[model samples]
Target: MSSKILTCSVLSALATAFLLDWYHKKFEVTTPPTKNTPRKPRKYDDSLIREQLSRNYSFLGEEGLGKIRNTFVVVVGCGGVGSNCIISLIRSGISHIRIVDFDQVSLSSLNRHAVAQLEDVGTPKVECLKKHILRIAPWVTVETHNELFDINNAQPLLMDGNPDYIVDCIDNIDTKVDLLSFCCERNLKVVSSMGAACKSDPTRINVGDISCTEEDSLARSVRRRLKKRGVLKKIPVVFSSEKPAPGKASLLPLPDEEYEKGKVGELSALQNFRVRILPVLGTMPAMFGLALATYILCDIADYPMEPIVGKSRTKVDGIIQSLAGQQSRLGNTEQRIPIPNNDIIYIVEEIFRGKSPISNYSTRLTLSQWDPAKKLSLQNIVVMTKEEQKLHEQRVLKGGEKLESVYPPEVIQLVEKRFAEEKFYSQFR
Candidate 1:
């Protein structure tokens, strides 16, 4: 009886303890946030926050909006193209930008450069542009490098923030080449601007296959120099080739001329020549800049590559047949085959239209009858003697004549068809 009474007492004690713990939790009084403590403002009720978010969504849709807001773009020149590109990137919702340049704003720069203003004169391009960007997007992270991009400093500047894309707007050819090689070696994607100095026609400006040559003088010179170095053989480039109007000789000495002058004494008398500067408004650079930004964004978003439009190659084939007398007895003697003149044309037609060749060339060749017995039968023979071969080599070496299309016609046709079919998706994908 005593053991049963002890067990009942212990059970009652355990139930009493459980009731005490439950009572503490059920009727507890909690302290509110202290006066000194801070609370995060609700994002939904903030109009500024809502507007920024809406802009991001409107510019870069839901799928890639986050990526764009987080991306870093390094623009390597604050001249015409760089300034325009940076502005477009900011307006497109890109939140991080780095401007690198060693130039100071001058009076002449105000006419063409987007970010150059009267008040910005004498200021470093990088600093001035960063200030402009901050004014537009205060939340954006803007960094500036007031140094020229050279072999020694390029690597660090390029790799510093782990840039997602690099835009080349440098004017010097050697510098541009160095930047391209550096980016290519590091496997970083980059887009470069070609000669935009002397062109005026906006319609003539275009982005296209880098292999094809345009008739513009600046492009030709660039192509020659780049080809000599084997750089333009495969690198994709964005350039315009519209011929500039003839003007007075240039007053501003070439970069090489300046170097030579530095080697010599400044007292040496060198006649200054006056050259015409191309009239560049905001439209062409703006268009190309936006296109470049679109390409970069599309790449980051895992979209299909956009086809660069360029000159198309057109080829024509003709067969010549000799007339025979009706009901006449045929001779068994070796029949003679006549040669038909053939021509190939390389044309820069409108990207939308598929008709008309821009340039044409005709060449004549000797023809021979096909032989079934031979493994490789002769159909049309070009019996170019040694002298002809020597002349052809001479012309090629002298760069007297442009070659026929560098690519096959069928390949170009296939590419054009693919471009047309996938163009819409490429724009926003």
Candidate 2:
């Protein structure tokens, strides 16, 4: 009726709008959903650091407790092997701790401070180990620096908590060789603690790699001062191969009004060679601080750990080549300087003691010999033989021990030609 039914209903409404746009582009339609889209939240944490490290879930599960809750340990000595290696690294779940030390809590550090007490003697061992690690991981983050870690604040307290391991337990061997050369020049990750003072076996404790330490004489003087500071890498410690024993407790030398009522500093002969009366047996620094928190939580739970076993096969260059062919009966050189001038035989017996023409005997035979081109010169008329001035006034009353030094003119020209003989100045002049 209208141009053939309106061109056949406009070709059936343009083939029903091209079959509904090809059935909505080949079937796919439900669209209503978009209000900040997100649906992935399978996380839960009933933290007590996961219920007291929930028995480290059959050996560190949950990806080793999520890498021990993002690792960061620092512990440079809090005392007694860094307070039992920070109490087995905060009860073995360490969730970021720092704890450097200035030291306090003394009354002789309660035998081997494991978070010491006696009302925490004088406190500040990083505030009693950060209040005993917040009474055991109060969602741990301990930190505390409390000064005295040396080398100008040890590289900003070891990269301001950038640590992933650094339990050195600092007992000052030049601040543990400047914090092991500042963590081997930024390669970081450290572990050190040699010489747990006059050790008491614990089966000769040991770990390794300060060049494979042996017979631990403080790891052979910290491996000869880290090989004179070039720092031959390999550092990793926890040493003790017996050999310290033998101390019968003798720090004697008191009486200055009983050593000023229990000494308060002023004993320096390098602090009496580091205050030794040496008996220490608080279970060998709590078993070398729980074997250095079991080598920092078993190398952060990758766990295979087994290197240190009965150390001391003894080859520190075969004990320094058995102390190099043993020759040192006081004769290395300097024309035979074996140290025995006795004030140039008491100034050549007061220029030949009592009587005999001498007038300082040619400046005392040019002060007994060894002028290896120049240096040993003794001749201020030093003659003392009334029992050598009564044994030098009882060795300056037993304290001023500086038994005079500089002597090397062929060891005082053999005690000045065996006491300037002419029948020994005619029998003591």
| Candidate number achieving the greatest TM-score relative to the actual structure | 1
TM-scores, all candidates, are 0.56, 0.26
The models' CA-based lDDT, in order, is 0.56, 0.61
Q: lDDT per residue, candidate 1, 298-384, as tens digits?
A: 666655675545433322232222111100112324343232222111111322222211112123321111111222112211122
Off by over 4 Å in 1: 1-50, 53-56, 216-234, 243-283, 303-305, 313-429
Q: Give lDDT tens digits, candidate 2, residues 1-429.
A: 779999999999999999998865544223522321211111335564577777875676777757766897888878788888887777777777777777578787798888778998976777777666655665665667666777888877887747888878776677888888878877898888887776665765778787765556666776788778887888878886553212322234545674667763554324422543444667788899899888778778777777744432322332222112111221334333332443333334333332222232322122222222333234212233333333333442223333334334653564445344433333322
| Candidate 1 lowest-lDDT run of ten | 320-329
Question: Residue 392 error for model 2, in Å?
Answer: 48
Q: Clashes in model 1: which pairs? A: 249-274, 249-275, 250-273, 250-274, 250-275, 251-273, 251-274, 347-358
**Backbone atom clashes (below 3 Å) for every candidate:** 8, 4
- lDDT for model 2: 0.61
